[model samples]
Target: MISTVVWGTGNVGRAAIRAVDAHPALKLTAVLVHNPDKVGRDAGQLCGLTHELGITATDDIDAVLAAGPTAVVYAASGDIRPDEALADITRAISAGAVVVTPALYPLYDQRNAPPEFRDPVLAAVADGGGSLFVSGVDPGWGNDVLPLLISGLGTTIDAIRCQEIFDYSTYDQEDSVRYLVGMGQPMDYQPLMLVETVPTMVWGGQIRLMARALGVQLDEIRETSDRRPLDATVSTRTMGEFAAGTQGAVRFEVQGIVQGEPRIVIEHVTRIHPSCAPDWPAPPGGGDGAHRVVIEGRPRIEVTVEATDEGENRSAGGNATAVGRLVGAIDWLVGAEPGLYDALDIPLRPAVGKLGRKQS
Candidate 1:
């Protein structure tokens, strides 16, 4: 069994713990957390399971690395403290741990990554003989593997569009929703997330990844964004009040142009409240959220995936799938030579031996 460590105990971290524990070939060894209150908590409690898993959370990073764990799931939030997250990950990699994470946006497409982001991690892998895989749903399997796999069904393909439609009010992240994305804020308040080139910096790699897989040379990448204001003030259960005329929904796309046309597209329909954007595409059955792929081709194929976890939260469901993709890859990375990898290199294998199984 590959001894595994889960770093961070947030939304993504909770799912990572559960995924690692349930996997057949993985051993849950430790969990690292930044909060002192979480330090001695059982893994089960941290991840919402009723019973303890006999593993305690720790803030001692050096001790965790000294244990020489074979793998680690870095589920910490990199949105705010990206450099620190990178430091934590590189430190772990240099200790010879096969690390996988949804953090690190620049490395999502390793080949296209900037030298500054690429060089240090490569040096780390060489120093300690470890491998790294970076991926998530938006710039992750939703675009990389899912679209590429489904595009195969088309006799002739046109544009490949991957979409994430979600209602973020149920999403637990308040500051991110209100401040970063400008939800519930006045239209004049420009969000840092939607600033020029930020969308390109984030989702542009996914466009490149799909283009490479399809063997299409991208002439350039493009970005398009639209925002809508709430018609009336609103109040959410988790977050308090959203004033009338405040920003409520956002739609953006990063498009890959090939031969003067967009060949691959990654679109997001994110709404703070369901009633915010009526015309924008929404989750099927008007549920919380979904990841969808629309392949404009001979078969006109479309696929929608909806996942719910942690008390039927769609956001948690998406996080769990991201964890599934990363955690399921631990055993494979253990056997492969230490290096860097991406969604393109990592095969999306089904749950081979996990069916009808009971968790320990």
Candidate 2:
């Protein structure tokens, strides 16, 4: 079994722990945390499980690395702390641990990643002969493999649009929703996630990755955004409150122009309240969130993926799926060449063997 450590204890981190424990080919060796209070707690308890996994959470990164796990599932939030997240992942790679994560956005498409972010990861892989795979819902299966696979069924394709439509009130990440995304902030407030060139930096790679997979080159990439304000004061179960006229919903698209038309697109329609943007697209089945793939082509294919955790938490469910995708690849990555790999390089079947072994 491959010894693995799950770093971070956020939504994704918790899901990673569950995934690692459930995988027959993986052994949950350690869980690294940044919060002091979380240290010394059982891994299972940290993830809301009733039983213990016999592994304790630790805040010491050096100590976990010293254990020399074969792999590290870095699930830390890189949105607000990109530098630290990059350093943590690179160090793991340099320590000869195959690192897989959804943290680093730039590394999502390593082929087109900037030198500043790509060079260090490549160097670390070369120095320690370890591999790295970065993927998630957006830069991950949602945009790359899912769309490409659907396109194969089409006799003629006109456009491919990947969308993530969700209500963020159930999502418990306060810092991300309030600060990074400006959920309750005024319309004039600039969110870090949707800032100039940031959307391109985040989802643009996915556009390029998909274009490359489909054997097409984009003429150019473009970004468009629209925001809606709350019609009235509203309260959420997790987040406190949002006053009227504040930013409540956001819709944006990252388009890959081909043949002078926006052929490949990644669109996000996110709202803190369901009533905020009734005109915008909603998730199928009227769920809290979903990842959708729409192909405007001969076959006219449409695919929607909804994730729900044990408690019907859509946000956690989405996070768990992302974690599963990353952890399920550990076995494959262990035997593969040591280098930066994209979703196209890793088959969608990595989760095949682990399917039947899912924990109840």
Candidate 3:
């Protein structure tokens, strides 16, 4: 049944077209939208998806690739414009489809990309025979595939630290306060603006996919940032309505090394005002919007992930666990393995449902 389209209606392209309109092996088949006031309309009410699935919304990318969809998720516009979004993902993989993207910085850190945009997206997915995968949820699963799947339960690992503290006070205020915490005024300020190189253009490919799955080989990559303010006002019903102390709080740290030794460290903290960390305290049975993973020496491991939601949307628990792991990796990104894959080559199991399920 494959047949999917879903380009961009925003917010992970309307949650990946309501997860391909409630996947049953998938088939929503169209909804492009470059915003001519939301093209033709109902892609389930331009993504409120309350009922109808007649599938509308189009800006005509050759009539939605001649209405022949086998794959195309490209959740457009995260801003950095990786060469005009890899030239629209190489024209939707040369019109044959099969392209999945979360587009925030091409392939994260594909060997410090810029070989004119990673050799033309790896020669347009090998001359568009098709197949491409990129993940989400913080460099696709809290810094590259959950630290290579916790170093496969370790044999003799040394380091890997990933932490993502949340509470953006229910994001969306122009994408969490004017493009992710830049907030108002100051000539659209800049200073570690969400950690320079723009959050490593979205996870510096999770530090080169954890140095190519722990084989470890890296020479350079460094970034650091910290900001605190929001000592008061922060509100969100739909990422707006602020008052208390205005808003401002952002932190990012990414460190990955091999030859010089620091293994990996990725940290992202966003707080538009929410506290608890009287200087590092809540361990030993963590809770309250918790997401933690710490692995250091041999036989030492700790993982605490708790954030679930269903209704009155209090930041719907990190957008339903980052849109249910990017909608269950859309059928293994339509038979993956082309070039560039993260979230540890994608396999957290339970895609359309399961894995902390709650979205009916």
Instruction: In candidate 2, list every pair of residues with a backbone clash.
Output: none
Number of colliding residue pairs in model 1: 0
Query: Per-residue CA lDDT of candidate 3, range 1-360, in tens?
Result: 788887887766776777677766778888888879898888887667557788778798887877667788888865645677888877777666677776746565565556776677677777766666666644256566666687789778787878776655555436545554665323335643564577666666777777777777877667787555444454555656445434355566777766787668777666554542224323223332455667888898877666545343334455556665766676776776565454555688754443463334
Give per-residue lDDT, candidate 1, residue 104. 89
Rank the candidate models, highest lDDT first: 1, 2, 3
Can you give the TM-score per candidate against the true fold?
0.98, 0.97, 0.32
Cα lDDT of model 2 by residue, 225-258, tens digit: 9999999989999999988999999999999999
Q: Which is the winner by lDDT between candidate 1 and candidate 2?
A: 1
Ranking by TM-score: 1, 2, 3
Q: List ranges where model 1 is wrong by over 4 Å.
A: none
Error of 3 at 310 (Å): 30
**How well does candidate 3 score on lDDT at residue 169?**
53
